[model samples]
Target: MMLFCDISLAARIERAETRLIADSSDASRARRGDTLGFALPYAGGVASFAEPDSPLNKVAGLGFEGVPSPADVDRVERAYAACGAPIQVELSTLADPAVGDLLTGRGYRLVSFENVLGRTLDGFQGEPPPPGVQVRRSGDEEFGPWVDLVVDAFGHADNQGVPSHEDFPRAVVENAIRDMAATGAWRLLALRDGAFAGGASMRVTDGIAQLTGAATAPEHRRRGVQSALLSARLAAAASAGCDLAVVTTQPGSKSQQNAHRQGFSLLYTRAVLVRTA
Candidate 1:
């Protein structure tokens, strides 16, 4: 059965994503120093600065809890400016029109859009992936390898799709993956013909299974590695008591296509608005 996604569902996913940003703050602080890793409360969400060029650098879950106060908005802008980073706000389209109006009035330009896809975990039994592809949780000794493979997979852009607004260096992606693991994400690996072919990760927040990220190495692409990894995560999530599983993908990208094939639905779209510093 398809799950009905109302504004309430969006709020839950947004809040869960924002909290992951807080975890990124902790991971950044551990990787760098106390001077960095700031997750400031803004409006009803958080303005997180895990690192200057971090994918986690953004204001999320805003305006859902409440309107963005002028004082809070000013403070968030100043904080990002101090860090020498652009202020990116991931605003749900379901948000009040006033929120977008306020952001545009402050000179934030729409940079891109990402779709939030989801499926309810009601006795979902994922189908077996294509032959030669196997999925399993990465053991502690395998975590380092997991990061390496996933980041490498991330580096090879999809041949076609709406491009991502931001791309970080390999080192930056590695750090972010480490930070995500520090925040309690379970690393999962996909093996093709008994070799390390790809990796992915997930974190459960408030009974919502947040599919943090997943990538298949270039050599292993088009072999159903990603789909297999996703199925493994869904099964694990359902077993862990999660009611909903969500993944954010570039609009019309291969990832979104794979998700759609695996029974996920488009729940909402997050408009990426930016104020460059």
Candidate 2:
């Protein structure tokens, strides 16, 4: 039996690819005055930076190796200053450890932690759905509610910094939705009873489909809305020529339990380290 884990992994990667493709063109750099640029992460150790001084910062083809040393840190800081964007690096747990320490030593604060988890789907069996709910894909008209569910689910009253002056959460989500629409990279699905209950976004890249912006409405708890959404998304990925799907979450949270229910297992645990440089 081809392990379900293989399928799970492939779907996750494809979803990520879809995001990269969807956001590549409009990956705006941090604003000229804000000293920040948009950083859209991708696989293959490839990620991009954007800002007013993007050209000088060498936004094109900046490859992440192991943890960045002081010199590398200087290079990034210089890039940020030149671009008029304050320096903030969203380093993956997989980011070079040396770089993490260097930034921490410089006083960069840790803002958030994320975990990227995966599992095989070869022999996977989905859980039963709650009563009166059904799964369906979303389009432009339904996109707004989907975005709302994500913000609400994440419990963000508003994104406090950066994006408000720069390209913040709203901008990021809007840009993503636009890109997904343009390239058909997004697979938005809703679980509801003639109303919005829960939703998810699935995009593919490099044979891996990355899942993002999944959430249930505050009023729709414990009714299998998420489970249905997950099962539907995995099936969609398989039919859409994907090899696997990867979902990232904060480790040891309710979200992890949700992933487990959907047949996703631990692929790896990534840690986020930060400092004020």
The estimated TM-scores of all candidates read 0.97, 0.66
| Tens-digit per-residue lDDT, 114-155, candidate 2 | 556665444344555667888877777876777677656644
What value does the lDDT take at residue 75 in candidate 2?
Answer: 59
What number of clashing residue pairs does each candidate have, in the order they appear? 0, 52
lDDT of each structure? Answer: 0.89, 0.53
Candidate with the greatest lDDT versus the true structure: 1
